[model samples]
Target: MKEKLVVFSGAGMSAESGINTFRDSNGLWEKYDIYEIATPEAWNKNPELVTDFYNQRRKNILNVKVNQAHLEIAKMENLFEVTVITQNIDNLHERAGSSNVVHLHGNITLAKSSGPNPEKKYYPIKSWRLTKNDLCEDGYRLRPHVVWFGETVPMLMEAQNIIEQADYFLVIGTSLQVYPAAGLVHHAIKAKKKLILDPKVSEMQVPNDFLKIEMTATSGIIEALDLMR
Candidate 1:
């Protein structure tokens, strides 16, 4: 059997594909307050604003193309049982031909009901525009299927299981700052090898054996693929 390779990716991984990171210098978080547009409270306070925010995000991603980093990562399937665990809401990974992907954050192209049961079902939207009046089959208004702040990451357990099973654990473009998601690195403690790729990796804790590469996602992944070869 091929060795299991789990890729723990973050916003920076998608940034190479033109998807903006949430907390980068000119990132979406800078233009909008997280509490205003990315929280359960915000969705409740102003559902219209929340809908508009995600609509724009969906529109942005519709035009964005998957970058070299995503392509290279997908190619890893030839050597390993590759599973990409991403913090992004975009579909770039899927578009890049990656077979197994665990989305830690919710998907922007889908919508869930805001009724009494918000997490039970999700509806797919063809267009980038998910209007405020759009309702689910349950007669409740539709909301972006994103895992906003203050909400649990439904796929965390699945991700941990994948990480624990990894023979090789690769972290790309993540600052490893966010919680729950950030904590996933620990789950890979049993992995035989760990690799991290980021330009400005700071004082984050990791296994002493981790191979740290300081570069952008595309460049870093290129080098990583070479090393794997």
Candidate 2:
């Protein structure tokens, strides 16, 4: 059996592909108020605004390509059973040919029903525009399938289990600042090898045993793969 290799990725993983990180010094959060655009309160207060914000982001993401780092990570499958647990809502990991991926947040390409019903149905949208008119089969407004702030992270347990089984654990681009997601590193503490790829290492808090490759994702991934080989 191939050794299990788990990769935990964040916004930095997709940033090189032209997607913006929300927590960087010059990230999207700098321009937009988090409570106004990325919280459940915002969604309830102005659903149209929330929809518009995600629609624009989806459009931007559609225009971006899967970068080399994604490809390199997928290539790891040749030597290991690779599983990607990403905080990014983009489908770049899947697009890059990764067989298994768990999105810690929600996928941006999908929309879920806002109905009062107990069950929520997700619908795939071909266009970047998700308007208020878009409705699920239950005749309720469709909202972006993203895990906004103040909402529970439904995939946390699954991610934790994946990390705990890792023979080798890798974290790419993420600063390890976000709660719950950041806590995943603790699960992989017993892994044979652990590596973190990020240029801004000074700001991150990670295990001392983790191999810190202080560089951009692309270069860091290349060096990491070489070291693994």
Task: Spell out the clash pairs found in candidate 2.
Answer: none
**Tens-digit lDDT string for candidate 1 (21-99):** 8777988777888999999899889998888888898999999999999998898899899999999899898999999
TM for every model, in the order presented, reads 0.95, 0.95
Q: Identify the runs in model 2 with alpha carbons over 4 angstroms from their true place.
A: 116-119
Q: Which residues of candidate 1, in runs, are more than 4 Å off? A: none
> Each candidate's root-mean-square deviation in Å?
1.3, 1.4
The 0-to-1 C-alpha lDDT of every candidate, in the order given, reads: 0.87, 0.87
> What is the TM-score of candidate 1?
0.95
lDDT of 2 by residue, 1-229 (tens): 9989999999999988989898887899998888988897898899988888899999999989999999998988999999999999999999999999998888999988776641366678879999877888888788888888887788999999889889898888987888878999889956888888898976788888889899999877889777655
